[model samples]
Structures are given as C-alpha cells and as structure tokens.
Target: MQNFDYCTPTRLLFGQGVVEKLPEVMSRYGKKILLTYGGGSIKKMGLYDMVKELLKEFTIVELSGIQPNPKYDPSVLEGVKLCKENDIDVILSVGGGSVLDCSKAIAAGAKYDGDPWDLISYKVKAQAALPIVDIITLAATGSEYDCGGVISRTATNDKIGYVDPLLYPVVSFLDPTYTFTVSAKQTAAGCADAMNHIMEQYFCEDSTILNDGFMEAGLKSLMVNAKKCIEDPEDYTARAEMMLTCTYGCNGIYSLGNSPTGWPLHGMEHVLSAYYDITHGVGLAIITPRWMKHVLSEKTVDRFVKYGVHVFGIDSHQDPFTIANQAIEATYKFFESIHIPMHLKEVGIDESRIDEMAKHVADNEGLENAWVPLLRQDIAEIFRASL
Candidate 1:
C-alpha cells in the first residue's frame, strides 16, 4: 500500500426528511445566504418552497439556471459578483453536482479580487473561501464530498478539474428522496459515472487488497441497484444505495493508499465534453471500455484479469489476455445494457474533431503521464475506437 493523507470534513445529514434540518444547519453560517440551483427542478419538486419556508428568518439571494458541465463566464462570475455585492456569508447549493461545483468555484472566487478563471485554471491558488452547504438531488460527480469540481470555459472549449482543499463543502444534506424523481437516462448515466470512479482507482498500479475489494463491491452494488432504479424510480432502497455510492465516488476514500492512475478516462472525456457539451457521464461510459481495450497489454493484463474475475465474475481459468478482453467487453455491454449510447457517433461526435480533441487532451490533461502513458496518437486511436 502507498502512503497517504485523507480527511473529509463535510457533515452529512443523510436519510429521509433530512432537509428539514436545513434551518438549524444554516443558522451556523449566518443570515446572508447565496442560494444556487440549476434550472427550476427544485421549484417543480416543491423543495424550493420547503426550503424557503424553513429559512424564512434568513435573507436569501438567488443564483439559478446553473447548467451541467458548469460554465465559468456567467455562473461563476455572476456568483462571485452576487457574493461580493451581498456580503454573502454562506452559499447554499440546492441541486445536483454541477450546482455545487459552481458554488465551490464561487466560494473560492468570492474571496479573490482576480477573475474566477485564475483560481479554476490554477493560475492562482486560493487562500481562503466562503463556507458552502449543499442539498444534493443527484447521484453523480460526488462534488458534495470532494474538493474538486470540473469547470468548463466555453470560449476555449476547455473543461478543467479544479481541486483545492478550500473548496470542500462545510455541510451536505443527502436525502435520497430528493433523487427519487431522477429520470431514467440520468439514473443510468449517474451509475456509469460512479462506477468509472471506482474503476479508475482499482486499475492503478499500487492498490491495497482491502481497497480493491471495497471498490469491487461498490461497482457490483451500483450495477445492480442502478438497474433497480431504472425499473422503478421509486425504489427507496435502490435510490439510497445509489446515492451513497456516488457520494463516495470522487472523495478519494475508496482509493486511499493507492497509487494514482491520473484518471486517464476522465482526462480524455473532459475534452469530449468540452468540445461537444455532451453529458459528462455518458461521455465517460463511451470512452471507458475503449480506453481499457487500448491500454491492455502484458503489464496491465493481470489487473484486468482480477477486474474480470472479481467484478464481472468472468471465468478465471482462461488465459490472461482473454480474461482481459472479456472484462472489457463486459464493461461495454453493461453500459450499453443501461441504455448509455456506447459510441461517440451516437452522441453526435464525429471524426472531424478527433485530432483536435486528442491534441488538446494530450497537451492539457497530460495523459502521457497516466498509468499507461498514452500519447496523442494513442488517445486519438481510443477516440476512433470509441466512435
């Protein structure tokens, strides 16, 4: 096992009706609140009224319509302006990961006089950030429990994963009931997103047996429960398990003491999402198996064998290469079975921009330093194969 230092400071208020505790939690942060959300789903679900009723004693400032793959221009900049103008004491993000992500960036940016992009792009490091509290309504990205958020610069077609310990949420309200109304498409995509998080850590070179087992179980649970969710969105147990699984996805606890893989699939998928503005999880599902196939070799076959046997229950008696191939195929089929568009073309990506994307990923994401060390050509080939 590798050496590591880990801490997750977010206070989790989990289970049904936990949002009722919002008033008590918000009291600690003061009355000046920046309420952030995406679209108007919370209002449609009646959560907006409930939250408003609970916090009627507090002064609330609203920043709505935060999009998925959260943008920097209007959302981040506008949020910073709101915080500065209102003397916002705390930010309460009440939506999915994207809203919380934008809130995180806003938290960091509000304290800095410079443009928020400087903080997001790592051109400047954050010294201090405003406190953040969130109520999660989705089971993807795990932003509630992590300090990293993926932000997109639309003009440059750049999506960057910004990480700073200052960005972790001070509190996260996780009521699975909030996710009961999630659409079928998002349910599957969220599962794919969470599963890929575990796989990224599991496939690394230096991993503990205990961590591997934990990840394998997480993958199995997500696969099974995600299907249950698709079959019946109101299944409380399935929604709860799926919600918890994704909450743990990007927090680094599942991979403690493990060598980093540089998360090559995410590195590549960022470019795709940056260029096309497609769904983040769907892009990951389409790229994962293809990247797995491209990176399979003698050095990586043993890991794939273990993945096949343990996660998918593939026949272990077969040769290592065959087992590896079977594992990759099983991964592809599982994502497809969940109704994820398994090809880039199906998601409206074509070959015209493959070269540009590959070059951008290679230049920006540093995939050449990944566990398998993919070159620009290798990444382009994986993109081609994914198509």
Candidate 2:
C-alpha cells in the first residue's frame, strides 16, 4: 500500500429533516451569511422557505444563478463582490455542487485583495478564507466533502479544478429528501459523475486489494441505485445510498493509500464542458468508455479483468483481453442505459473543434504522465472514437 495522509473536518448532518439544525450550525460561523444557490430550484422545492424561516434571525445575502460547470466570471466575481460589500462572515450554499463550488471560490476570494483567478490558478495561495457550510441537493461532484471545485472561464474555454484544503466546508447538511425532486436526466448524470470519480482512482498503477474492493462495491452500488433513482425519483433508500456514495466519490477516501492515475478522463472531459458548455457528467460518460478502450493493453488488461469480474461479474475465466473489452463495453452500455448521450455529436459537439480541444487537453491537462500516458495524437484518436 502507498503512504497517505487524510483528514475530513466537515461535520455531516445526514438523514431526513436535518435542515432544522441549520441554525445551530450557522451560529458557529456568524450571523452574516452569504446564501448561494443555482436558479430557483430550492424555492420550487420549498427548501428556500424553510431555510429562510430557520435563519430569519441571521442577516442574509443572496447570490443566485450559479450555473453548472460553475463559471468563474459573474458567479465567482459577483459572489466575491457580495461578500466584500456585505462583509459576509460565512457562505451557506443551498444547491448542488456548482453552487457550493462557486461558494468555495467566493469564500477564498472574499479574503484576497488580488484577483481570485490568481488563487485559482495557483499563482498565489490563500492565507485565509470565509467559512463555508452547504446543504447539497445534488449527489454528484462530492464538493461538499472535498476541498476542491472546478471553475470554468467561458471566454478562454478553460475549466480548471481548483483545490485547496482551506476550502473544505465547515459543515454539510445532507437530507436526501432535498434530492427527491431532481430530474431523471440530472439523477443519471450525477450517478455517472460519481462513478467516474471512483473509476479514476481504481484504474491507477498501484493500489491495495482493500481500495479495489471499495471502488468495486461503489461502482456496483451506483449502477444499481442510479437505475432505481431513474425509475422512482423519491426512493429514499436508493437516493440516500446513492447520495452517500457520491459524497464519498471525490474526497480521496476511496483511493486512500492508492496511487494516483492523474484523473485522465476528467482531463479530457473538462475540455469538452469548457468548450461546448455541455453537462459535465454526460461528457465524462461519453469519454470514459472510449478512453478505457484506448488505454487497454497487456500492462492494463489485468486491472480491467478484475474490474469486469468484481464489478460487472464478468466470467473470470475469460481471456484477459476479452474481459477488458467486455468491461469497457459494459461501461458504455450502462451509460446508454441511463440515457446519457454516448457520443460527442449527440451533445452538439462536432468534428470542427476536436483537434483544437485535443491539443488543448494534451498541452494543459498533463496527460503525458497519466497511467496510460496519452500524447496529443492519442488524445485526438480518443476524441474521434468518442465521436
């Protein structure tokens, strides 16, 4: 096993009716809260009213319309403006991962006098940040548990994953009931997002049997529960389990003591979402199987065989190449079963920018050191295969 150090400081209040505890949690930070959310889903679900009623005693500031693939421009900049202008003490992100992700960037930017992009791009490190507490409505991205967020610069077509330990939420209130009203499309996309998180870690060069077991079980659980969620959006057990699984996805716990795979699929998919502004999880689903097929070889077939046998229950006696190919096909079919667009063309991306996007990914994402070591041409081939 590889050496590792881990800490999860965020307090989790899970289960039904946990939002009632919001007052106590918010009290720990202060009364001046910058409440962040995306669109008006919370209002539609009545969560907004409940939160307002609970925190009526505290001073509230609002920053809404934080989009998915969270934009760095208006959302982050406007959030920072609100925080600075209001002297905001804490951020209460009441939507999906994007809102929380935007809140995280705002939390850090609130403290820094320089441009927030400097901090996000690693040109400078933050010395302090506003405290963050989140009520997550979507089960994807695991931003509530992890100390990172993906921010997009639409003008430049750059989607960067900004990670800093100081950005971890001080508290996360997870009531699966909040996700009961999520649409089937988003539900499936969220499942795909979380499953990719595990697969990225599972396909690394070095890992323990324990880590493998965790990831294998996680993959199976997500596949099963995702279908359940699509069929019945309010299945508490399925939504609850799926929510917890995704919450654990990006926090590095599943791959504790495991070697990093450089998260190659995410590297490829980021360019897609950055360029086309497509759904993040759908991009991942489309890229994952193609990337897996491109990377499978004598050196990697063993891992694929294990994944096939353990996660998908492919016959262990099959040839290693056959098992690997079967595993890849199974992955593609699962995404298609969940109704994710399995091709780039299906998602409004065409051949026009494939080469440009591929070059950008190769140059920016550092995929040369990935587990399978993809170069520029290799990335282009994968993009074409995805098409």
Q: Which ten residues in a row have the lowest lDDT in candidate 2?
A: 1-10
Question: lDDT per prediction?
Answer: 0.94, 0.94
lDDT of 1 at 25: 94
Q: What lDDT is reached at residue 208 by model 1?
A: 85
What local lDDT score does residue 330 receive in model 1, on the 0 to 100 scale? 95
Candidate 2 at 109: error in angstroms? 0.4
Q: What digit string (tens of lDDT, one per residue) describes model 2 on residues 163-241?
A: 9999999999999999999999999999999999999999988999898999999999999999999999999999999
Put down candidate 1 lDDT per residue, 80-133, tens digits, no spaces.
999999999999999999999999999999999988899999999999999999
Lowest summed lDDT across 10 adjacent residues in model 1 is found at 362-371
Look at candidate 1 and give me any clashing residue pairs: none
Residue 48 error, candidate 1, Å: 0.8
TM-score to true structure, per model: 0.99, 0.99
